[model samples]
Target chain A: MELSLATRTVAEHTVLEVGGEVDVYTAPRLRERLVELVDAGARNVIVDLAGVEFLDSTGLGVLVGAMKRLRVANGTFGLVCSKEPLLKIFRITALDQVFPIYSSVEAATGDGTGSGPTS
Target chain B: MATVRLSFSPAPVHVRTARLVGVAVARRAGVAEELLDEVRLAIGEACTRAVALHNQYGLADLVTVEMSDSDSYAVRVIDHAPLEASVGLTKLPPDELADESLTDDALTTGVGFALLAGFVDDLVVRPVEDGSGTEVRMVWPVQRR
Candidate 1:
């Protein structure tokens, strides 16, 4: 299936909601979208993965690249992913330590008491 | 023994088809429900890696994927890229992977075998004998009725 992307401002943070399968075929779109957001001067971004059904290494790579880009801009990047399968991927890659992952968009945009982002 | 074979042009679009077919076969082969996600992810990674290798070397060959349930559920993704592509990335030992985690180059290029190693307990990457390219084989235990 094709990847779906929607961007909205929430609590002063840009929330990009992603849906559908993210694989080699569809990851570039996500990458492009992330680039657009950063180039548009979105400082704080939270990618909501709650609607995402599948994610692969290519998708993960896109997310990692986005995080690094935002970090370079001295902005904050976080992920809202609570699916066990998707969480398992992050855990396996040890990316769970790299991104500030939240259970929901509210939690991600909430007070900065969630899991801290790593360098 | 039931087996499914898929051969597709080394294109990114075909990787999803390979994953879907691989997971369907794995389920019919009696692979546990909980491990289906792992199977799907592993298959996707293997196919994606093969496609990347082929594209990198400008090869127009087809990537072949085979899944069989003769014993444990096993899947193999074969690519026709140059031999060196396989040599440089496929054979790293586990101990050396700590330094390879999430490198910028690795993420932009290929996630490589380290991520696949995390998903499949039984994983092997080796050069195709009597030919160029690499064969990535992954296995997961299954219950036979």
Candidate 2:
């Protein structure tokens, strides 16, 4: 399936809402978007994966890379996902511990705690 | 028991195709929703590895994926690379991974066997009987865990 992306600004945080299956074919689109945000000096990013149906290692790799990039820039990053399928991948790679997962976008950006991007 | 066999060019674009075929078979086999997700990721990883191996080793032949529904669900990703070309992706020791967690650089570096081990019930790696290549086999019980 094709991955559709929608981006908007929430306060200072950039919210990238991704839909469709994230796999080998569609991961690069997400990767490029993340890079673009970093290049644009956007910090405090929250990836809303609520609409994503499938995510594989390729997609996970992109998220991890984005996290590292944001971390280097002293930014904040987290995920908004509750789907069991996506959650299962985090558990498999033990990334669940690394990234703070929020149940919803409202919960994720609502915190405003500003811990900086870590996921 | 039912089985679906697919062979395709070892390219990244075809990886999703492989996953789709495998997931379709598993769904028909009555794999639960949660478990079906695992099946999708597992097949994607397997096909991805096989395709990468073939490209790295300069093998022009197709990569084969076999999904079977016997007593248990199983997927076999066959890569036609020679033994000498082995990347040894499945050789990571358990202890090496016990304390280690996923890192972006690590995931970008190479293949991931941990996901395979953690997501599936069983994983078996063996050389093809005719010494042509390697078969990465993984299985999960039909009943939900």
Candidate 3:
């Protein structure tokens, strides 16, 4: 129910840490934030979903929308999700392949020399 | 052979009520926690949609939720809103894959009927025989990974 956004710059990439539940009631806020970043010329975006407790279809739709927007601009969007429940949902929906998923925010942001994508 | 039935005003509160009842039933039926979450989310979506459409037409009526356990757990959510108000899964158009404007967060993230269809294994939405309200029946199989 609570949403928090934190921004960090890593090498030329912009990482956005999203925490909280993303549902129909909260997805609009996330979309607005993504739009703002895209408009600001952030081409490389990483969404850190480590703190996300729940994700619904509404949340998935927002992510898909963001991916489409960034793809059109020749940009990229990646995700960092460690929660098993959330990961299961993404895997079942086959969205795990739609977005590049990393194990941690550091890997997602490619911070200086961190672990690379987990298979 | 356990069933729980209740009636409440068709509003946001009903959504929460349905979720609570779903969790309770899943627990009593010894369903797994992960599957319990799935059932709760599915029921929440169905009841919320029914309530929203029912309220739009000034059809303030009691929303009846029935949770029954048989070979598998099932929920029947009925609202006094006319059947015409109910939106069918087949009637909903696919997501506009090519429209930029359609990517609006609200349009993309709103709990559409499509998501409900994907979540529940057995879902049926139809009019009551009395032609008064919409009835949504959802079944959750007992064995789930």
Candidate 4:
């Protein structure tokens, strides 16, 4: 229902903390934010979904679009998803293969990652 | 026969209405809690799609939602938005097998008709007769693993 976006820079990586339900109505806002950040030359991007209680296909679409955009620019896009229900959705869709998922924001921004390819 | 009807504007409230109705129906049908969550998500997706289409055409008025449970649970979404060329399931192109975008987790996963198709056992979309609006009916059989 509500969306709060916060951005922090860690070395050269840009961390985006998104807390809210990302559905059709709110997806456009997320897409716009990712585009702005990518265009501004923020390459390595980490999306923190720890606060996201719900996500749908539209939200997934925006994230996918951003991942492609970032990859095309030879950048990296990672995710921080902790919730089980949300994580199940990602795994069912095999998105666990696309986005490198970390257990926590610290781990995602930390040394070792899980499932997805290392950058 | 367990049934419930709700009417709300084609706005954000529609999503909540769909979710509530879906979970309620699933519970009444004695469906498992995890499966009930899937039904709720599928119904929410369908209602969201309908609302988005209606809003795009400036038809932000009352939309009727009918939830019924018989041998199967069904949710019928009715909206007065002008049916456009792009609104039906048939309008969607064949699944793009080679489109990596479609397979991408961030792109293809989660709430959509695709998820509904994957979750619900039976999904049907058709135009409502009498030249009124679109009707989307989705059914989940009572017995499933």
Q: Which candidate is the best by lDDT?
A: 1
Q: Write the per-residue lDDT of candidate 3 for residues A53-103, one digit (tens) a residue.
A: 666666777787788889999998888887777777665555665677899
- Best-matching candidate per TM-score: 1
In terms of DockQ, which candidate is strongest?
Answer: 1
Q: Candidate 1: deviation at residue B105, Å?
A: 5.0
lDDT of 3 by residue, B1-145 (tens): 7899977777654566567777898778766666777777777767766666666767778778888878788889887876666644332233343246654333432434555676777988888888588788988767534
lDDT of 1 by residue, B23-61 (tens): 999999999999998899889988888898888889999
* After superposition, candidate 4 runs with Cα above 4 Å error: A82-84, A91-98, A103-107, A110-119, B81-111, B141-145
Binned by DockQ into CAPRI classes (incorrect, acceptable, medium, high), candidate 1 is acceptable
Candidate ranking (DockQ, best to worst): 1, 2, 4, 3
Off by over 4 Å in 3: A111-119, B1-17, B51-64, B79-119, B132-134, B141-145
In order, what is each prediction's RMSD in angstroms? 3.3, 4.1, 4.6, 4.7
Candidates sorted by TM-score, best first: 1, 2, 4, 3
Candidate 3 docking classification: incorrect
Residue-by-residue lDDT tens digits, candidate 2, A41-113: 9889999998998887678778877887898899988899888767776766677776778887777787556
Share of the reference A-B contacts seen in candidate 4: 0.24
Q: Ten-residue segment with the worst summed lDDT in candidate 2 chain B?
A: B91-100
Q: Write the per-residue lDDT of candidate 4 for residues A15-71, one digit (tens) a residue.
A: 999987787667789899999999999989999898886787778778878887887
TM-score of 4: 0.75
Worst 10 residues of 3 chain B by lDDT: B89-98
Model 1 Cα displacement at B74 (Å)?
1.3
Model 4 residue A62 distance off true place after TM-score fit, in angstroms: 1.7
Model 4 RMSD in Å is 4.7
